[model samples]
Target: MEALNLLESFVRSAEAGSFSAAARRLGITPAAVSKNVARLESQLGVRLFQRSTRQVTLTDSGEQFFQQVSGPFSTLRDAFASASQDAGKPAGVLKVSLALAFGREYLVPLLGEFLARYPAIVPDWHFENRPVDLIQDGFDAAIGGGIELTEGVVARELVNTHIIVTASPAYMKGRPVPAHPDDLAVLDGIVRRSGPTGRLRAYTLRNQAGDEAQVAQCTRMVFDDPEAMAHAAMLGYGVALLPTTHAAKWLESGALMRLLPGWHADNGPVSVYYPSKKLLPPKTRVFIDFVVDAFRDREFAARFGAP
Candidate 1:
C-alpha cells in the first residue's frame, strides 16, 4: 500500500509538473509529495527529476520509467474507481476540455441531461479553440474534433463530421452563383487559419467529370475563429467554409446556401478521449456511454444529417 501510494504520488507530481501543484490536487502537503517521490526514486535506485528553483524536469530515465508505469497505474486507478461505484453513487469532480463552439452549441445541452441523470457527480469544464495536453493538465476526459491520440490515451469515435462551403443569400442576390470550383476565383473567399500551423487552407472542388481542381484565386479574408467567420459569411462579407454541424441551422433557415455541395471533403471524426485504462470510473463510463447513445440516436442523426 505504501508503494502504491508512492507510485500514485509520483505519477501525479510528474503529470502536474510541480510538487506543490500535485500536492494541492491530491489534498496533501508539498513536503509529503516530495518525500514520496524521493522514496520512490530510492526504491528504484533512479533519479526521476532534475529539480531547480523555478521548475522541475524529468530525467531521461524518468521518462522511460513513466512510460512503462503509466499504463498499469491508469489501470489500477480505474479499477479502484470502479470498485467504489458499488459502495454508493459516484461522487467526485470530472475534469473535461472541449472545443469552445461545439461545447456551447452541442455539448452544453447534452451535459444538462447528463447532470440531471447524475446529480452526485460534479464537472469542471474548460472550453477552448486550441489544443491542450490533457495529461499535463490533469483532465479526466476531452471532447473534440480531430483529436490525435497518443500513448497513455484512448480515443473513441463519437461522430463523423463533414465540411461544407457556404455563402449568404444576400451575397448570392446580385452575384452569379458559382457553377464550378474555378468560378470562385471571382468571388470573395473566407478562409480559416490553421490553429497548429497558422496556414490558410483553400478547398479543391471536383468537376462533373470527377476530376479534382482547385478553386481560382480570389480576394481572401482570413479569421482564426470559426464562429466569427460564419457570422461574416452570414453578413455577405464572403464565402465561408465550415463544418456541416456548425452550418446546419443556417442551412435550414435558408440564411446560407451550400456551394459546390458535391465537392466537400469529409472532416474525419469527432471523439471523446481519455487516459487509457483497464476500468473507467463509473461517472466517466456513464458519460461516454451517454454521448455514444446520443450520437447514435435516429433523432440526433436527423439533426446533423448523414456524414
Candidate 2:
C-alpha cells in the first residue's frame, strides 16, 4: 500500500506538473506528495523531476519510468478499486468541470444533498465557460453544451439546450415588441462571440410550425460569456439570446422577459461527460447517477428546455 501510494503520488505529480495540484488530486498535503516522490526517487537511485517555484518537469529517466509504470499501475489500481467498491463505500476526490453560470445556478445547489448521500467523496469542481480536456486535465467528469466529443469520452445529455430571445422589461418598456423573428433585426442586440472559435455566433431561430429565420440583430454589445450576456440583458442593455439554464432565475424574478416567445434556437443538449472506461471509478459513477436522478426529480429537463 505504501509503495502504491508512492507510485500514485509520483504519477499524479507528473500528470499535473505541480506538487500542489497533485496533492489536491491525491487528497494530501503538498509536502506529503513531495516526500513520496522523493522517497520513490531514493529507492530507484534516480532524480525524477526538476522542480521550480511554479512547476516540475520530468527528467529523462523519470519519463521512461513513468511510461513503463503508469499503465500497469492504473490497471492494478482499478482492479483493487473495483474489489474495494464491491465491499466498501465509494471514496475519493471527485473532480468535475462545469459551465460557469448553469453550474452555479443549478448544479452547485445540489451539493448539500449529494454530500449527505455520499459523505466519503470530496467535491473538487471547477467552474469555467470553456470546454476542458477531461483526460488531459484529470477531471472525473464535465457538464456543458457544445463540448467536443473526443475519443474515449462519452456524453449523457441532461437537457435540450434551447435559446430564446430575451430583454429586460425596462429595455422593452418603450420599444416595439418583436412580433416576428425578423423584428429582432431592428432591436439592440447583445451578441455573443464563440469562445472556442473566436467568431460571432449566428443564430437561426425556429418556430414550432417548421419555420426558420436567421437572426440578424443590430449588434449593440458583444460578450464571450452567457452569464455576462444575461447580466447585461437584466441591466437593460439590449435583447439577448439566452439558454433557459442561464435565464431561468432572472426570468422568474421578472428581471428579463422572453421576446418572440414562440421562436427559439436549438443548440445541442447540455450533457454530463465522462471517460468510457471499462472499470469506471466508483466515485465518478455515483456522481453521474446522482446528477441524472437529480435532474429527473427536479424536472430540470423540462424547465431548461422551454423557459
Candidate 3:
C-alpha cells in the first residue's frame, strides 16, 4: 500500500508538472507530495525529476518509467474506486467550474436538493467566465458554453441558448421600435466585448425562413460580462443582445422587452463536461445525472429557445 502511495504521488506530480498542482488534484499538501516522490526516488535509486523554482521536468528515466506505469496505474485506480463505491455511498469533494451568471441564476438553486440527497459529497465549485482544461485542472466537471471539447472529454448538452435583442421600455419610449434587424444599427447598442479576445462580440440574427442579418449596432456601451450587459440594458443604457437565460427574468417582470421578436442569434449549446472515463467516480456520475435531470424536468431547453 505504501509503495502504491509513492507511485500515485510520483505519477500525479509528473502529470501536473509541479508538487503544488499535484497536491491540488490529490487533495493533499505539497509537502506530502514532495516527500512521497523523494521516498520513491530513494527506493528506486534514481532522480526522477529536474526541479526548479517554477516547475519540475521529468528525467529521461522518469519519462520512460511514467510511460510504462501511467496507463496501468490509472486502470488499477479506477478499478479500486469502482469497488469502493459499490460497497459504500458516493462520497468525496466534487470540484466543478461554472459560468458565473448562469450558475448563480439556475444551477446554484439546486444545490440544497443535491446536498440533501448526497450528504456524503462535498461541493467545491468555482464560478468564472472562462474556459477550463478539465483534466489538467483536475475538475470533476464544468458547465457552460463555448468551452472546447478537448480530447478525453465529453459533453452532455443542456440547452441551445438563443441570443435575442432586448431593451428597456424606457429606452424605446420616444424611439421607434426596430421593424427589422438592420434597424438595430441606428439604435444605441450596449455591446459585449469578448473576454478571451478584446474584439466586440458580433451578432447575426437568423429567423425560421433561413434569412440572416448581421447586427451593426451603434456601440453606445460595452461590457465583458453578460450579467453586466443585461443590467445596463435594464437601466435603459441602450439596445442589447443577450442570451435568453440572462434576459428571461427581466423579460418576465416587464423590465425588458424583446425587440424584433422574429430574429435571434443562435448562441450554441450550453453543456456539462466531464472526462470520458470508462468507470466514472460515483460522485461525478451522480452530479452529472442530477444536473441533467433538473434541466429536463424544468424544460430549460424550451425556455431558453428563440422567441
Which candidate wins on TM-score? 3
TM-score of each: 0.84, 0.83, 0.95
Q: Which prediction has the highest lDDT against the true structure?
A: 3
Selected candidate, larger lDDT, 2 vs 3 = 3
Residue pairs with colliding backbones in model 2 are none
lDDT (Cα, tens digit) per residue for candidate 1, span 1-307: 6988899888888887788888876779988999999999999999999887756778999889989997788788777777776465765788889899888888888877888888877988999976666677677889987666777788888777766678999998888887777787888888887878888866665444667877654657889887888889999998887877778878889988888767665666778888766676888887888888887873544555432
State each candidate's clash count. 0, 0, 0
RMSD of each: 3.3, 3.2, 1.5
Per-model CA lDDT versus the true structure: 0.79, 0.89, 0.91
Q: What is the lDDT of residue 95 in candidate 3?
A: 93
For candidate 2, write residues 1-307 as lDDT tens digits: 8999999999999988999989987778999999999999999999999999999999999999999998788778877776776347888788899998888889999999999988988999999988898866778999998888898799988888788999999999988999998998889999999977889999999888989999988999899988899999999999999888888888889999999887898877989999878788889999999999888899987777762
Descending-TM-score candidate ranking = 3, 1, 2
As a TM-score, model 3 comes out at 0.95
lDDT of 1: 0.79
Off-target runs (Cα >4 Å) in candidate 3 are none
